[model samples]
Target: MSALFPTYKRFNLSVKQASGTTVEDTDGNTYLDFGAGIGVCNLGHRHPDVQLALENQLNQYWHVSNLYQQPIQEATAKWLIENSTGDQVFFCNSGTEANESAIKLARKATGKHKIISFKQSFHGRTFGSMAATGQEKIHTGFGPMLESFHYVPFNDRDAVKRAVDGDTAAIMMEMIQGEGGIHMADPDFVQEVAHVCRQNDVLLIIDEVQTGIGRTGKPFAYQHYDISPDIITSAKGLGGGVPIGAMMAKKTLRDAFGPGSHAATFGGNPLAMAAAQAVLKHVFQDDFLHGVTEKGRYLQERLNKSVGDLPVVSSIRGKGLMIGIECTEDVSHKISSLIDKGLLVLNAGPNVIRLLPPLIVSKQEIDVAVQLLSGVLTDEKASIT
Candidate 1:
C-alpha cells in the first residue's frame, strides 16, 4: 500500500531524526549509525559547520542559472582541485551524473568509443554510467547497452592489458569496490593500469563516488596509490549530506567539454556548494584524516581479533574506514538482526557486511559497533549448524 515504487527493499525502521552517528526512530528508539547513509554523511548527520554554511546560503539564495556568476561553485571546485591532480571540474547532481559526465568527457576527449571497466565494479545507474558498470545484474534488462564497454577481471593486470586497445576511451575503476563487495584493488595493479593507459593514450578515469570526500581517510582513495588518473568522478560524501557531484579532469581536456557539451541545471547550486565548502574545509585538514587512518587501523585490528575466527565469518578486508566482513552464509538476516538490536549497517554484495561509519566516529563508537556485530555474527554462526 505504499505510493513509492518497489525499487528498493525498504527497511522496517522509520528514521525520524539523525545526528552525529545516531538515529532516532519514530517510536523514540535510538540507534548508533554505522552506515552513514551509505557513505553520504561522512561528516555525520547535519554537521554544525555544514549546517551553518547551508543556513547562510539559504538566507542569501538557493538556485540560479549556471550562466550567472557563481563564486560558491567555483570555490567548491577549487577545493576539489586543491586535493587532486585534476584542474577543471563539471558539477552534477549525484554520483551517477558525475560518472555519466566522466564517461562523456572520456569519450569526447579521446575520440574513442569503447571503454574498459572491471568486472564487479560499480559506477552508477544512469545509462552511460550503468554501461560503464561491469555487473551483469545491473544490465539485465537495460539492453542493448550503450555498446563497446569491455569488462575484465579486477586486479588482473594481464586481463586489463589484453582488453585495452586503440578504440578504448578510458579504463574506469573504483579504489575499493564499494557496492561490489568492498574489494580492494592492488596498488601495483592500479599503478600499472595508469601506466598502460598513458602508454596507449587512453584516459584513466577513477570513480571515487563512494570512497571520496574523506570516506577513505583521504580526499579520494586514489591518493593512497601513486597513479594519477586523467579524470575523477566524485559525490556521496562530497556535500556532507547535500546532493552534489563533480567530475574533474586535467586542464588538458578542457576544450573537449567546451561550454555546450555538458551541464546539470542544479549541478552546483548555492546550498550544495556551501555545504561542500564547509565539509572540505574541515575534512581536508591533516589532523582529521590522520585520525581516520588511525581509527581505521584500530577498527580493523579489533574486528580481526573479535570475529576473524568466527565460524560464520569468512574474511574481513578493506582500507581506511570502509571495511567488509564476508560470511559463510547469506548476511541479510544478520543485518536485520543488527538493525533490530540498535545498530544500522549495510551489505555490500550478498554475503559481505560492509561497514562505513562516519569519518567522525570515535574509538569508543568503533568498539561498540564491533561488539554488536560480533554478538550477531556469533548468533548467526550458531544458527548455521
Candidate 2:
C-alpha cells in the first residue's frame, strides 16, 4: 500500500540513482534510459555543470520574491532571448505553468477569448493548459473546462483556416507533438498557421515544452520552420532536470504582461536560474547542437535499419532525439518487457514507444538500446505469429 496518490500507473522498479543515460534501481540493477525523464533531462541526470551551478547557487541564495530584481534571473532571461526568437520571458515552475502564462498573455494582449489548438496536441494539465490540450481523454471527469478553445485537425491548413475567426485570440501548437505520439507538423501547415495568425492579428504561441532546448537539434523546434511565433513556452530541458519553465514573447508583447498582470512566486529563483544558465551555455553551443543533429540522424537510421523490418513495428517517426516507434500491438507490455530487460522506454498513446535519450548518449549506448529493442520486437513478432 503506497501513501502517495494513485495518479500514475506506477512502475514496480525503484530508481535509486541515475547518470548520463542509465539509471540504477534499489536492487543495483542498471537500465539504459531512453525516456530522459520524459524529455526533461536533456543534459542527463546530475550533469557536472548543472550540479556545479546548483552548488554555487546553494552557497549564495535559493529563493527570493519576484518583487526584487535578481541578476541571475536577468542573466538567464538574457541568454534565452539571445538564443531564441523571443525578447522577453516569464519564468514558471513547470511546462504547464509556462503554457498557462502563455494563454493568459495571449488572451490579455489580444483582449479576445477564443484560442485555436489542434487535435491530439497536449499543452499541459492545469486548467487553462488542460483546456488548450485538444485530447478529450485528459478532460474526462474534469467537466466545465475553460471555454473559448477550438480544436482543429493537426497538419490540416484548411481546417485551421476555417477554424480561425474574429473571436480567436491565439493559435497554439507544438512544433512536433510530443505527448500525442510524436507527430511531426507539416511545414506547409505550420507556415499556413503562422500566416493565418498574422493576417488575423492573432498571437501565435508555440509550445516547446518538449521540443525546446536542443531537443530537436535546434535551440527551439520552431526554428526548424520559417514561422515566427509571437510567444513560445519552454520547460522540460531548460533547467537540465531542475524544475523551471519559461514563457518567452516578442518585444512587441513586452507590455502585454504589466507588473500586476502575471507573476510567479518561485519562477526565476537563484537555484533554478543557475541550472538553466549552465544548460543554456552548453546547449547554445554550435558544436553541441550539431552533434545532436548528427546523433539524431544516426539514431533514426539505426532504428530504420534494425527494427523497420520487424513485423511488430508499424512505423518510426519524430525529429532529432524525440523519436517514436509505433507498434502493431499494445505497447504497454512491450515497455514493461524492455524495462525488465534493462532498457527504459516511454509509451506515447497506446501503441507508440517514445524514445528521448539524453543528448549526451554515445553511439555505443544508442547501439545497445537499439539492439535490446530489436530483440524485444523480434520476440513479440514471434509470439504474435
Candidate 3:
C-alpha cells in the first residue's frame, strides 16, 4: 500500500541515482533512459553545467515574489525574445501554466472567445490548456469544459480553413504534435494557418513545450516552418533539468495583461533563470544544434535500415531527436518486454513507441538501444504467429 495518490500509474522501480542517460535503481540495476522523463531531460540528467548553475544559485536567493524585477529574469526574458521572433515574455512554473498564459493572452488580445486547435494536438493539462487539447480520453469526467474550442483534422488546411470564422480568437497548435503520437504537421499546413491568422487578424499561438530549446535541431520548431506566431509557450528542456516555463508574444499581444491581470510567485526566480540561461547558452549554439541534426539523420537511417524488413515495424517519424517508431499490433507489445533488459522507452499513443533521448547521448547508446529493441521485437513477432 502506497501513501501517495493512486491517480498516477507508478513505475515499479525505485530509482536511486542517475547520470547522463542512465538511472540506477535501489537494487543497483542500471537502466538506460531513452524516454528522458517524457522529453524533459534533453541535455541529460543532472548535466554538469546545469548542476553547477543550480548549485551556485542555491547559496544565493531561491524564491522572491514576482513583485520585484529580478536580474536573471530580465536576462532570460531578453534571451528568449531575442532568440525567437517574440517581443516579450511571461514566465511560469510548468508547461501547463505557460500554456494557460498563452491561452489567456490569445483570448485577451483578440477579444474572441473561441480558439482553433488541431486534432490529436496536446497543449497541457491545466483547465485552459486541457480545453485546447484535442484528445477526448483526457477530458473524460472533466465536463462542462471551456466552450468554443474547435478541433480540425491535423495537416488538413481545408479543415482549418472551413473551421475559422469571426469568433476564432487564435489558431493554436503544436508545430510537431509530441504527445499525440509524434505527428509532424506539414509546412504548407502551417503556412496556411499563419496566412489565415494574418488575414483574419487572429493571433497565432504555438505550443512549443515539447519541441523548443534545440530539441528539434532548432531553437524553436516553428523556425523550421518560418511561420511567426503571435504568441508562443515553452517549458520542457528550457531549464535543462530544472522547472521553468515561458509565454512569449509580439509587442501587440505583450500588453494584453495588465500588471494585476496575471502573475506567478516563483515564475522567474534567480536559480531557475540561472539554470535556464546556462541551458540556453549551450543549446542555442549553432554547433550543438547542427550535431543534433546529424545525429537525427544517423539514428533515423539506422532504424530504417535495420527494421526495414521487419513486418511488425511500420514506420519511423518525427524530426531531430524526437523520433517515434510506429509499430503494428505485433511490435507494440515488444516495447514492454524490452524494459526487462534495462532500456526504458515510452509510447506516444497506443501504436507508436516514442524515443526522446538526451541531446548528449552518444551513438553507442542509441546503437545499444536499437539492438536491444530489435531483438525483443523479433522474438515477439515469432511468438505472435
Candidate 4:
C-alpha cells in the first residue's frame, strides 16, 4: 500500500527521530544503532556540529550552479586534499557519482578503454559504476553492461597481473569490501596492486565510499596500506547525514577533467559543503582518529571474548568501527531478534552481521550492543537446538 518503490526490504520499525547512537521509532521504542545509517552517519545522527552547519548554510544559501565561485566548496576540497594523498577533488552527490566521475577521468587521462576492477568489489549503482562492480547478482537484470571492465579475483596479486592489459586505464578496488562481507584487503596484495598500476601506467582508484571518513580508524582507509592511489572515491560519512561525495585525484590526472569534462549541479552546493566542512573539521583531528582506532580495537576484542565461542559465529573481522561477525547461518532472524531487543544491525551479505557504530559511540554503548547481540545469538542457538 506504500507509494514508495519496493527497492529495499525495509524493517517494520518507523524511526521518527535519532541522536548520537540511538533511534526512536514512532511507537516510542529506542534502539541502540550499530549500523550508523549504514556507515553514513559516522559522527552520529543529527550531530550538533553538522546540524549547526546545515542550519547556518540554510540561513545563507542552499543551491548554486557550478558556474560561480563557491568558497565553501573550495574550502571543503582543500580540507580533503590536505588530509589525504590527493591533490585535487571533484565533488558529487553520492558514492555512485563520485565513482562515475573517477571512471570517466581515468579513461580520459590514460586514453584507455578498459578498466580493471576486483571481484567482490562494489563501486556503485550507476551505469559506469554498476559495470565496475564485480558482483554478478547486482548485474543480473541489467543486460549488456558498459564495456571495457575486466574483473580479477580480489586479494589475488597474480590474477590482477593477468587481468591488466595494454588497454587498461585504471585498477579500482575497495580497501575493505563492505558490501562483499566486510572482507579486508591483504596489505601485500594492496601493495602489489599499487605496484602493478604504476608499472602499467594505469591509475589506481580506491573506492573509499564505505570505508572512508574515519570508518576505518583513519582519515581514509588507504592511509593504512601506505600505497598512493592516483584517485580515490569517497562518500558515506563525508557530510555526516547530508549527501555528499568526492572523487579525489593526484595532480597528474587533474587536467584530464577539464571544466566541461565532468560536473554535478548540486555537487558542491553550499549546504553539502557546509556539512562536509563541519564533518572534516571534526573527523580529521588526531584525537578523533585515535579514538576511532581505540574503539575499533575495543569492539573487536569484546566481540571475540563474548561471542567467539558461539557455534554460530565463524569470525569477527574488519577495521575501526566497521566490524563484521560472520555467522554459520543466515543472520536474518538474529538481526530481527536483536532489533526486538532494542539494537539495530545490518548484514554484509547473507551470513555476516555488519556493525558500523558511530565514531562518537561510547564504550558503554558498545557493551550494551554486544550484550544484546550475545543474547540474540544464544536464543537463536537454543531455538535451533
lDDT value for model 3? 0.87
lDDT of 4 at 201: 90
> Each model's C-alpha lDDT?
0.93, 0.93, 0.87, 0.93
Report the lDDT tens digits of candidate 3 across residue range 98-198.
Answer: 99998888888778899999889998888889999999987899877799899999999989889889999999999889989899989888999999989
lDDT of 2 by residue, 70-183 (tens): 999999999989977899999999999999999999999889999999899999999999999999998999988998999999999999999988989999999999889999
Error of 2 at 303 (Å): 0.7
Whichever of 1 and 3 has more TM-score, that candidate is 1
How displaced is residue 45 in candidate 3, in Å?
0.8
After superposition, candidate 3 runs with Cα above 4 Å error? 330-332
3 against 4, candidate with superior TM-score = 4
The local distance difference test score of model 1 is: 0.93
Q: Model 4: residues >4 Å from true position, as ranges?
A: none
Backbone clash pairs for candidate 1 read: none
Candidate 2 deviation (Cα RMSD): 0.7
Candidates ranked by lDDT, best first? 2, 4, 1, 3
Among residues 3 or more apart in sequence or in different chains, the pairs in candidate 3 whose N, CA or C atoms overlap within 3 Å are: none
Candidate 2 Cα deviation (angstroms), residue 172: 0.3
- TM-score of decoy 4: 0.99
- On a 0 to 100 scale, what is the lDDT of residue 31 in model 4? 95
